[model samples]
Target: MLRITDARTGDPVTATPARRGLTRVEARVERPDATGLRVLLTADVLVRALEIGGTPVWTVLTGTEDRAELRARARALGIRPFEDERDGGPGPGLGEAQVLRVCARTDEPAGGLCVEVAPADIENGVALDDGSATALRLALLARPRGTELRLDAADLADAEKQLKHWRGAVAGWATRPSGPIPDPVRDQLRAAWEDDLDVPAVLGVLRKVETSGTVPDGARFETYAYADRLLGLELTRDIGRGTPA
Candidate 1:
């Protein structure tokens, strides 16, 4: 339940995941210089987002406080944060600060792999879309304590195919009637689908509920998990199938 408020407006702004670690991540919004707004991070441990009651709840990351790691991550995105007192320390104060996370961004690459999207669920894995129509799934399984990605690259292709013919045959059973899932959630899911975002994974989860004879509850966090899984799975298959690079 971390909140990212607007530094200039003091409003509740959407705070995307910077990077999830277990060390001490002293996130601060350094003063915007001629370049732009400089965000700083001081952490050592990064973990996956925990979904509780359908909410992405990040854990309390406290470790050696690897400021370098966080700084490097920001740099990759073309965001430069002063490592030492080089460009002067962080701004007077952080305009925004909450439970820092390793939010996946589909717009760019992170680490070495280009994840499909950030982690929306703690149960699902991030994805790798190799510039193709397909994708691969990599579970972000942890030791039940953190949000670190727990799966290896080799295992991504082993996930069960979500779009198989047999799988679609059971859509009726898994499909939600209409009102079961809230409107806001439905809108969110709909928006994602329209953009070809994370449709299959979420719809797949709902279908699972139908197969189990349980109604699909469009829980906020669950929706996120479904979307993430679908996005990751798509890329997993894409990469696994060896689609042209």
Candidate 2:
């Protein structure tokens, strides 16, 4: 019942298109019994390894004991065993394709867990550093609200469109009267114009101009002008507010 996600996209499985016609993927142990779990490549365990882009990439292994027993053995060996129910994956420099990895507590009695590290690639694509990618993917999933803001190709395009429209709206306001502007309108324009600016700064300005509890119609031009000057964007059609000297 333990759930795990990649540190980058906050998903259990993340695919990377590092090579054409081949797919790179990453997964982790939901929770380790100790601090780090050893990976195994058993027949049953790897059957569920999903394929992406027609390439089945995974290796499988088996462990000697259940989570608890493995942890004890790991501790006795001086290497901190993986934590229980904690997510883990291999480190970087490990190839990504055609390798099945299972995180389990080890029970090797000879003072060492039987280490099985086999690296391979799918479709001739280069392998990834399994350990680094897993750690990064896990870190990404741990943050709040971080999952919502991932910028993909479509998102970037959408933002670009919005920016264009916002710029046009500001241009329209710049040419017309300047009495009051709705806070929402000003906020949107400010956001669009500032592009990569922080949201708090814009919100602060909104609070300041909204003291009367009403959105000033002319605030559109005023706010646009203010933001343009503050953020250094071209307020091309500034009519009411004189161009900054």
Candidate 3:
């Protein structure tokens, strides 16, 4: 059962589908800019989590102008393509009413949910070009949704360093035979993501797993691969590239 904080009611609600088999979800962006990238990525995470929980999701992206550029950025960040993409309907950008209209026009059930992400407060003179897109994604996921993301160069650097370290570590761990994810760690991971997509908590769990002497290397490899299903960080990319020194 996926539980998310209801943006409308401020209460935790089960993401139940109106229809038996499909849950309709729409992610709205006011513009196809850096802030929109955050919103798109968040929605992608939500979709992945839902699918992991055995829910068939129909996802739509609204208010995108440059489809080509948006798709490129999303691909670079490991976001799956949306099933449907369209511009916003008649209204003042992507306000609540506009979101509802977009959903309605697409035959989304009344139970369908719209995820409206808040804009990130990026520092002046900070360019996303400074770091890898995957690292930028990790940096963004480190922060909670609805809060203004004060992204800076240091955050990007830390994210890049963490990604590099994890990939290299995973490469080394992959030399051993695969094992199951430890039960406690699996539960912790599920709890974090199930509780309103608490990705930072999930990352904390990974940090502990990385350093714990009790976990076998093979188990560590499995644990990271499982978590990467949700993280989309491509942590195993370094595997077969030679282990870290």
Candidate 4:
């Protein structure tokens, strides 16, 4: 039931695994630039979502980019390591798995669905490596995949603030007995991520849940914990810190 907008057809397509029990995904990350990082992040998100839904994923990262730096940054961003990491030019021999060409729009499509990501326009004083890596991730996820990411100091600051608030809130809620996630909220969260990985929409659901008076605190905690499985935001990190003051 996982649907993603195919860059080739420009339409939503069901991502069916070629193999019965496993899905093979290849992501071409050409450079260690901003767009390249975005590509890596996007591919990671897709792979994680598939795995979360009970599909074993075999991920391959192939490109001429500096593998060391790329792997380092991916780890910093909380992206898991790919199963097959190789360095080569285009046309690496691939299996029947779905292919994702993560590159700029101007780059030639490497024979799969092209995920076009524009380079981030960071402000003069803003350094991507400076502050909270999790916040940087949130800022990136806030935008649609194909849109230009105009990251600035304000965006990073806001993302950091929101991340802190959510962690604190989750911690406070965790003090109460755990409760089941409401069916409607759970459905909404699943629908958002399943629909072409609409992470922004998923985040919107979290925002609403945060302020909803009807959802008991325990349920709120469970809701966030459920969403974090796909979000990878570490939303429950503060659970043992005893709620923030």
Which candidate tops TM-score? 4
For each candidate in turn, give its C-alpha RMSD to the true structure in angstroms: 14.4, 21.4, 5.9, 2.7
The C-alpha lDDT values of all candidates are 0.29, 0.33, 0.73, 0.78
lDDT, residue 75, candidate 1 = 44
- Once superposed on the true structure, which residue ranges of model 3 sit more than 4 Å away at CA? 17-20, 85-116, 124-131
Residue lDDT tens for model 2, 39-82: 21111112221221234443322333355654443333222222
Looking at model 3, residue 167 earns an lDDT score of 92
- Relative to the true structure, candidate 1 reaches a TM of 0.29
Which 10 successive residues of model 3 have the least lDDT summed?
Answer: 97-106
- Please give the ranking of all candidate structures by TM-score, highest first, separated by commas: 4, 3, 1, 2
At residue 180, what lDDT does model 2 achieve? 58
Better candidate number, 3 or 4, judged by TM-score = 4
- Give the per-residue Cα lDDT of candidate 1 at 45: 15
Q: What are the per-residue Cα lDDT tens digits for candidate 3 across 1-245?
A: 66776555557767653323565556665556668788788888887777788777666777667777887778888888875555544322331311221121222323334444556756677666524888989988988766666787888889899899999999999999988899999999999998878888899999999999898999999999999999899999988986573
